[model samples]
Target: MAVLGLLAGCSGGVEGSPVAAERWDPCSITPEQIAATGLDPEYRDEGWGKGIEIPDWGRCVFHAPGGTAYPYGLDVTSSEKFTIADARGRDGNLSVRELQVGGRDAHMYKTETGKSVRDCSIALEVSTGVVVFTVVYHTVDGVDSCQVVLRHVNDLESAIPAGPK
Candidate 1:
């Protein structure tokens, strides 16, 4: 009985552990930055919608210009509880590649349906956690989602706080 009790104690969960606060706010991206990415700031959606919230995450979605040739939306999510490794382990992520974006550790991943690339994301390492930029197309257009995501990352990389040296 003593040995069993010790084993159970070792398997106890870590409850009430505090997670680091997010270093960056997804909703804090300025309108000028949105315009630089060819997105309309007026169409930005906070938290994707009111009453929809993900614990430990800050999220915002920016829409492409109206009546564009290839319509799409960019969802920027920041989470102190998640890391680049967490993004790589996601079930639907494919072609996960580790790379450096503007001197910061980053991961690029995408989702595919048969031969079609559905969406792409770049997860950037930040001081407190990871900020993921995902570009999702509104239609089955031929535009490369990864390129679009990378462009946004480059444009906004300076805005994201750097991790520990």
Candidate 2:
């Protein structure tokens, strides 16, 4: 098995307002790199939060600074069927849906109460079988979800595959 690298958090996309970039220094590794390490980076989003009370389903992954915080941390697994939207804290009100992202299968779940603005997207890397899913949610005068999602995706892409760029 591959040595599991350090884990980190990423942001999704937002609808209305703009968002800023984020920078962090960790033992960065992509889904593909994880496989190279002899570990198959499975699941939908490795960094999924659990039992967090999110107002909207999309916002679950897309978190803002000082906004409604998620108590759970990232959950990683080797299951191909991963969930991007889950309302573990509240009732089963939250649900997830699947889609084709980056030429691969992906999922996007949201609550009915979520406005159209509350949407999520994902990209998958077939080479390393890495999935980059982003969820956009509304915040109370906070950063946009889109920004976070974009940054997370970018970071993962950069860290994976030590090959010709």
Give all candidates' CA lDDT scores: 0.82, 0.35
Per-structure clash totals for the candidates: 0, 10
For all predictions, the C-alpha RMSD in Å is 6.9, 19.2
Score residue 85 of candidate 2 by CA lDDT. 29
Residue range with the least summed lDDT across 10 consecutive positions in model 2 = 71-80
Model 1: lDDT equals 0.82
lDDT of 1 at 110: 85
Error of 1 at 113 (Å): 6.8
* After superposition, candidate 1 runs with Cα above 4 Å error: 1-20, 67-70, 112-117
State the lDDT of candidate 2 residue by residue for 131-157, as single tens digits. Answer: 334445544345544444444544444
TM-score for each of the candidates: 0.79, 0.31
